[model samples]
Target chain A: MIPKLNIVPFVSVDNMMKLVLSIGVERFLTELAEVVEEDFRRWESFDKTPRLAAHSPEGVIELMPTSDGTAYGFKYVNGHPKNSRTGRQTVAAFGVLADVGNGYPVLLTEMTILTALRTAATSAVAAKHLAPRGARTMAIIGNGAQAEFQALAFKSLLGIDKLRLYDIDASASQKCRRNLAGFGLDVTICGSVEEAVQGAEIVTTVTADKQYATILTDNLVGSGIHINAVGGDCPGKTELHADILRRADIFVEYPPQTRIEGEIQQLAPDHPVTELWQVITGQIPGRRDPRQITLFDSVGFATEDFSALRYVHSKVTGTAFFEELDMVADPDEPRDLFGMLLRAAA
Target chain B: MIPKLNIVPFVSVDNMMKLVLSIGVERFLTELAEVVEEDFRRWESFDKTPRLAAHSPEGVIELMPTSDGTAYGFKYVNGHPKNSRTGRQTVAAFGVLADVGNGYPVLLTEMTILTALRTAATSAVAAKHLAPRGARTMAIIGNGAQAEFQALAFKSLLGIDKLRLYDIDASASQKCRRNLAGFGLDVTICGSVEEAVQGAEIVTTVTADKQYATILTDNLVGSGIHINAVGGDCPGKTELHADILRRADIFVEYPPQTRIEGEIQQLAPDHPVTELWQVITGQIPGRRDPRQITLFDSVGFATEDFSALRYVHSKVTGTAFFEELDMVADPDEPRDLFGMLLRAAA
Candidate 1:
């Protein structure tokens, strides 16, 4: 059969999982982090825009779009905190990467898993610059769907060999601990948030709630550690206390968006925060001193998704991990679409 | 086998063509026009935003999103006028219809053919309200991909029996005339735009040039004629001369968007164009007099695409016209996405 120009390669959820397993999740995260870091180093080349969000009483559906002059990428993601009650994911996503020249979609992939991987990889990349050197222990508060990925990414990228996990629901922490069993990491489930953060060089807060519930207070946080605040991504949803934000040297992706959705929403509008690209490019200082508390205010950005999709597009080039989708209508005669339909009828 | 919540029904180009052909093109246009009319009546209830566009030297990629409180829909479309040189459609599209409650995508489908159908359907619907009563003849200048659809939609919805077609490339008009031969309409291939508009009650200028080209001048537009301007949809791209727009009582889908993209962009910033919805809802008059020159500035809106997607979604229920795509990652335990990947390995 001849290849159709309308066909777009699609990586379904099953195929995405198979691809991840084949590549080894840790290796995938490590390679993806390298791409994310490389993108950050030249972040000035990207066309950045804050996500367009449509908020409802139950959740928010967003379109995060960006382009790096050659490829345009966007992810359709939604966050509905109550979805889990119906056995649905609180956050689900999919994305497309298109050619900027021809404006045809090149890849369509399930981004729910990709989002988790990119988020963890992004956090690891930031921690590599901001976290204390030789950090081997990471206390992950809010052990939910994103917990194990975070643990593994830290292990793969930062070589963190120990994990301290904590969640309000103990079962969540237990599930995370079970998933990390054969990953060569020493995992411990802690009963309290304070117990999880005790004596850890890195503390990652990734709780998923829609309200301003403080999962980490300033009192619980110590100096000389990096904080990966992941869960506080939307307006009115934050995990760290205002006091914690005031104490740490916060860094963020896309300051305009981070100011609205990240933990910095609690701080003054003029509160100074460094852009992550600056640190990655060595334009600004990162982890100024051993005792400095560096916080990565992670609300997720479009470029990160763009990089992840671009990386996946490269990986699935000649692999059986994707199926061609007849997503665009390509008539034999470009201007004879009606004739094409008529021919189909015949 | 259990049904997965991650599965989203996708209508491929083949499936879409089959679905449209199965329903019959004329019937599809008539039914879709009704949905477009119905959506226009409730236009105020929709969450509307101007489309997000990324303009490049080659073309533009845009995301048009809207929601009617219950369901959300968005169309990803591109306009590349030069693409036809490479044997590609100048405009191609695909769209998604998602559930607003849980924010999971319910349907994904190709919109290239659907867009042509809806654009023609919408034009016919507008003409239904604005055109002269008993108008049977339409002169379509620029008979390209959209010409036959426009001709057939007018025939289906307005009972038009005569069509005069003209294109810069006479072969395009010949192709349109050939394709529309058996549709029980009187088709004429005119040598020039002036010849095409002679004795025609409705004139549609659907040229595809990206620059400002006056396909319809003021002298050619006579009284009691409705002008459906379809092709000059982007900024710096318009068909009618400014004098023609000055004489015609203009109507547009959305004023904010029309001011930038439609034919009225040549007019003053505060041009007194009536919103098409108001006329549909009977708040304002569409055609006030028999001798009035009415112009429908047909820059397609997101709501039209939304209505089209919603209609297709309803038609695809229990039908073989769609395939289920595992586009969202749903782990057995919502919090154990990592475990899902691990199990996939097993």
Candidate 2:
């Protein structure tokens, strides 16, 4: 027997989609949403900290690493909006899943497309618990790369039927409408953000600008609107107006991180915000009144990545998505790493 | 041209060894040593912060991420010394190199073997500045997987001929000795750490115990010795006793990280160890007298990874180590990320 050397399972982007779709995306999304909620509810088990960032003039590259007692994972992602002009993604990512016991990577995957998928999955999961009862219409402002995911996730998880979309570039909204054509969601391309938010039960601000732009003003937001602020992730990148944040009952992933990264950055340091885990664990009220303007400031936490990785890991098992390349060598002699390399060379 | 979207080069462990050997291990070590010195001298230009570590009961997993305003890199590494008992390497790692300007990953490589190579290269570079002039007869306590690299780096950088090796596991010493058989260095396997360090000019402790089991006591110390404390990285993991550390004038790779994760963690917060950059830049004195003791308290900083990644990136330029998979899409329209996936599905 050749021994179980090079055990880190790897899934390329194409293989990942193949694996996800083989199990059916809707069922995978459902399971992922459930697991995300499960982990978010018990967030205390995670070793939580702010994402370590290395800021450059052009953009910021961040590492979001988290570990429970059993498994450890980290994502290497960068946000460069200007990159799209150069025929590249505004964001590209890859991550590693390691066993906590031996601290070796068990899995590695390309996270460029997975990030958008997981981000929307997390938003939909949060919306299931935080959105107003029987919410059907979702207003998706800043209709861009994340817009389609949000639309599909909302439709898949929360039974959202209608999407009112708006972006500064009208073509972006058109793209969103075209992408969701087969997804069976009634998407309306709005001329303005206010028009997009009109009569929408849930408003998702998933923009790409790396600035504190007011995508949702106070005048546009009405009562009973569940605002999923996903764009305001970095320190200076914000979307919702400070007034809109102040008026709504806010919920966050991690309070310490959300205070600097989420839409709540606009509010005072002491501005009361409930952690989403408290709501999930039934320790705090979630959408107590149907008419309450509730906001889930979804900055895309590490636990979401954890849930997505685990969900994908479970779904992709017994599938041919992994390519077992020679990565970490399990040496013939435990102490002789050099001898293995020498044999490999020979 | 089809327009290559994401071209992050990858070097696996097998290819990495071939790369090191192809580049001539001696020349690779020397070049990487020079790169480390160059990067360290411009310390303030980097995003200098301590690593974000996720500790487990067995070992610790860490993300040592850093950027120098232009290029960014981070190594995902683990230290589970007991893993060898289960037929796994005590350390395994991989890292990414990204363009900080665009936040796009330009390179990703397995750093398990690269780490040991770079760590040894860094220790040798520090020893170049801190060790006494024309020193030979180096004592390497705990001759494990990394001992060969340490021996070679010293041989290449300083022309050191004599090696006094000692390891509790006799097999480990045999492994190290076998790896360096024809590498043109006289190796003598000693019985104990004291015998190995008896009359050596430079002492390097590269043991792999997780706890503060002092491998070098005050009795083992000699005059004019430069101790490269390579193991004892992470809190509560120390190789040298407090008295030995107190007697030796220590230098470290980032004080914040070294204080928390290096041998200096055993010392008080203000227990004065000079940053290696100061010595390299001539701002601080190293080896004041020939009789004075010097110690390079190496906890393996991010800057070294940055330099190593840069070196690997240069060496692997036209080599066939990279696979340009469809990780990030280059659709006709940037907003049609989903459409591209749909088309690929079709």
Candidate 3:
């Protein structure tokens, strides 16, 4: 039987800006967070794999794909540190959502912004389950492009009332403060990583140096502080030092990947760490004491993207993302893939 | 400085059909063949990997990604023999080509149809180099979805004027006959595999069963015949009998992948086979002698998809796909991804 020409919905970056504006960013974040939570709850249903990364001299490009029985999704993302000098973001991405039942792509969306939103939302999910109750203060070190999202997610989800932000580039810190000004949180511009980490209920390090920068040293990390380690997410690129990882109880999205890409990469191959899902599911201990330091090595995983794509697809339904794309050959005759094209020409 | 939101081109199945049709199927094949040949010549420039495949109980899903510094492309494809029974095609795919400089997808297109086109185009390109001069009669064993394309490609590229076709399903053979009738080829409906193989200059086995289907035994293959084996692309899915592969001078797309996914999976890991790229570049021998049995153990590769994506992208330049997607967030301030949404809400 000839499958009718498939119509894939296309979401351009311009329209994406319009859609996010129409949806209201707060409501979008809330909905995205819920989707993240829901998908994480049923994690085993997905056909998961560690993303395929091709490292070059400049940066890296990766393809992340996952599928449940019904639908498949994948994101193509690249990270080039030098891109900023060329007016490009360090990370740019696009993704596809397809019907696994038919193997036809149904939705194609620009994922550069979606990835940022999802990454922040993911950290919030981890922090909510692992952090101390009524956490009110967060120190956001490495206040680059992702800092504001991390700050807002903590504010929206974890009840963070104040942000102690720090960055070597003081302009980035200034930008972070300016961006989060009216986002319903008190902000403090800090002088150093140590100052940022001092007495805060949570510490978030999202520094983007493509090296072992050691943005968070061991001595600064204290008890009862939940550290959302976001930036050290590639092989040879790290933020937390080996001692800090050893001292703090570490949680990861996926062990196989975290071993290579997370802060724990500095630790032993047999380093004891808990999977965040286990903590979320209450299958493992999160924090034994209020004074215990919890470090979530947030390298990200394909499952999170699966969750994010599922969330976006659901929200986009009937929301006018259905710009019909001629992605599949819906021929009058199935065997005539050639004939279909020939007729189209005629 | 915030980069401009990426405008990814969307090529739907319909657009692809229209594009292929407008370009003319023969010209498209000829163009695509040239694309493959040209890329094959610069094989060393690509960051190539034998596609990352996830095998399951039902079938397999694979991500074939390749980049050449400037542009990166990947194809998401699946093979499930049981899918047809469930009202799905046995194979379905879609792909994206992106600017590595910006990490934004430049083109997103459904590859279900494109896959068939590229496979046929690739096989024909191989045949153009390896098939004996003035070869007319081709035996197409196990005529399935790809059978007609194989027929037309050989006819167009290698001047094969007569088709000796056989399928386990008589309806499949009839489909092949009906599809190719407009092409003006001398088509012969053979009853058995042996009958189809007899006296043919080139033999292409494009079967669909996910088993060790012995479509061609050694005894049936005549001296100086070219065997284009296309169906035995995944583990446990093979076409040629062990004796046939053992005797034939095997040619493959990529040896590493062919060892696992092609008919060569039946042979030893150390078994000798020439990569078609080598033959294309004249770095290795294709057919040792005119009387030798030559086999192109074609397990599709990412490089082939790279060639196809490039060809399609160039043809559809300046064409407007759709301007309604709201997927990328661009704000006056790059740091204000959240504020951009907030401003939109206001």
Predicted candidate 1 versus true structure: per-residue lDDT over B73-185, tens digit per residue: 99999999999998889999999999899999999999999999999999999999999999999999999999999999999999999999999999999999899988999
- Please list the residue runs of candidate 3 whose C-alpha ends up more than 4 Å from where it truly belongs after superposition: A1-5, A14-24, B1-5, B56-58, B82-88, B181-184, B318-328
**DockQ, every prediction:** 0.88, 0.67, 0.46
lDDT of each: 0.94, 0.83, 0.80
Question: What is the C-alpha lDDT profile of model 2 across B1-346, one tens digit per residue?
Answer: 1246644556777788788778877788889989988998898888877888888889889898888888888988888888988888888888888778888777778888888889999999899998889988899998877888899899999889999999998878888888888888899999998889877889999888899888999988988889999988989999998998889898998888889988888889999889899988899987789988999999899999999999899888888755554445456676677776666666
Q: How well does chain B match by TM-score in each candidate?
A: 0.99, 0.97, 0.96
Instruction: Sort by TM-score, best first.
Output: 1, 2, 3
Candidate 1: Cα lDDT at B120 = 99
lDDT of 3 by residue, A1-346 (tens): 1134455666666556677667766666677887887777777787777888878778888998887767778888888777666556788777887666555566777787788888999999999888988899999988877887787778888889899989898988988888777778999999988888777999888887788888887788887889899999999999887887777889998888889998988988999999888877778878778988898899888877777777777767777644555555555545445556656656
lDDT of 2 by residue, A1-346 (tens): 1247556777787787677667665666677788888898778999888888777667778899898889988887888878778777787777778889999887788787778888988898888888988989999988877888778888889999999999999988888898788778888999998888898999999888889898888898888889998989988899988998878899898888899888888888999999888888989988888779999998888888887777777766677887665668567765676676667666
> Can you give the lDDT of residue A33 in candidate 1?
99
Model 3: docking quality category = acceptable
TM-scores of the models, in the given order?
0.99, 0.97, 0.92
The numbered model that scores best in DockQ is 1
| Greater-TM-score candidate between 2 and 3 | 2
lDDT of 2: 0.83
